[model samples]
Target: MVCKLPAVFLLVPGIFLACTSLKPVQQLSEEARRGLGHFHKLGYNYAETCTMDCTFQKVRTFTVDRRLNCECASYQKADSVVWGLFRAMEQYWMGLSELASPGLTSYDLSAPVQSLHASEFVSLSEGEVSAIQKMAEFAVNTSTGRFRSRRILHYMKDADPHLRLLTEKLGFVLEQNLLGLLEIQQEEWYTHYKTQTINSELNAMEKEWATEKHYQLVEDAEKIRLKVVSLVAMLDLIAEKHHSLAVTAEKIGSENFRNITAALSDELKDLYVVFEQVNE
Candidate 1:
């Protein structure tokens, strides 16, 4: 719970009123950041998930060209792009959480090594991408041996749209790209295992073993799908919450702001509970 601060609404040209309500917003943004911290693992899983296409390419190379070609990084570009998007979005939310606080803070990003590649797969405009990417640069500029002040309402208003778009794109990448990969993997598993089970040359024991493996694969794939889908839902919720906040910016501490935020807090808590189960 945010401890109430008295009468900040009277100070700083109505900005402190905004700050007084920001702890919840900051908490929301922090939750968003925590959810994506495991993106490296997500990217690795995307690369390694089995696919019949990958197998076919490898086999064709070895057979036709007499070459031992292991396309181990088949999804490396997609992984890198996802990594870049995650990093950029993380920076934005992290900055938002920091900038919305009541006190001053500083953090360095001057020499942060992160890929920020945008691809044709991303449907964002160059200007929108640039705006999100600058969040890191903003941190670098503000935190260069100086404790920068917070309580900026205009900054929040400015970033809200671009950040919402980023949240959306992240969901799209996860659902469409990663989930698509998993679907292909499941299909490949079905084809591979079913073929073995139906092969007349295979003994009953071998066919049974193949059938068992197929069932296992199906179960595992379902688990991954549920996890990824939950992430997509979380992203959608974040965007919705952010949109609500942005549109109600002028109402900072009004009844409208309080009502929307109160409802959103409950929604966030429910989603956070869901994430706690998978955080392990």
Candidate 2:
């Protein structure tokens, strides 16, 4: 008996050829993708700001330490946590950008609106969707890892009760002395820092000015007293934003996304308890 190709294959000549289709892929909806990009960018902006504020606070604390001849290692440690949190956030945004626009090779974090929000939606392949899901999980895991390492409660133990008081004092001083200066002098600080090329002379001048300002602020015992308080507020804001982002990610993601981010949820609960205690 002469064997022949299967009847079905004969009827459809290329049906069993195992060729990949070149058909266009469906793109993610504009609203959904824009929302995702918005939240991702918002989280990233907050993280970046928190990092800068925390680092400035660290330097201020060190200035106080030197002037008063005391140790503020706890506050310094807290700053380190802030740095780690921002680093994790950067990674999260990168992962999110890759997920939302797999074809794009680079992301412009400073862009007012990430290009993901362009009118044309980017198509995601099946493999890309699966990769996106994995990336979301990784983002959540990294967030959890950053929080776990921070041990906020321990660092804030001696500092928490004074947060409100310090906030008030520092807010007043900042409003009186620094707010206008910041607005006028550093209105473009963030943008300039990212985009500008500073010569060594300009860098040295900025360093000198910063050093003088740090000493002046430390000379005011009230500011020094409230340094940790300011740090706590920054920390709280960052933690809150991080928790919100994780929740948003969970809502827009898969069942596995929820499971992977459960740790972040639990950590937020624990953080709330600490916040409540601090408030009391």
Badly placed stretches (over 4 Å) of model 2 are 1-70, 102-280
Q: Would you give me the overall lDDT of model 2?
A: 0.36
Model 2, 7-105: lDDT tens digits are 332224233223221110002122122222222222212233344454554553554434433344654554355445444443443433343343332
What are the lDDT figures for the candidates, one per model?
0.60, 0.36
Provide the lDDT at 174 for model 1.
87
Clashing pairs in 1: none
TM-score of 2: 0.21
lDDT of 2 at 117: 25
Measured with C-alpha atoms, the lDDT of residue 223 in candidate 2 is 32
The weakest ten consecutive residues by lDDT in model 2 span 20-29
Best by TM-score: 1
Clash pairs detected, candidate 2: none
Weakest lDDT window of 10 consecutive positions for candidate 1: 9-18
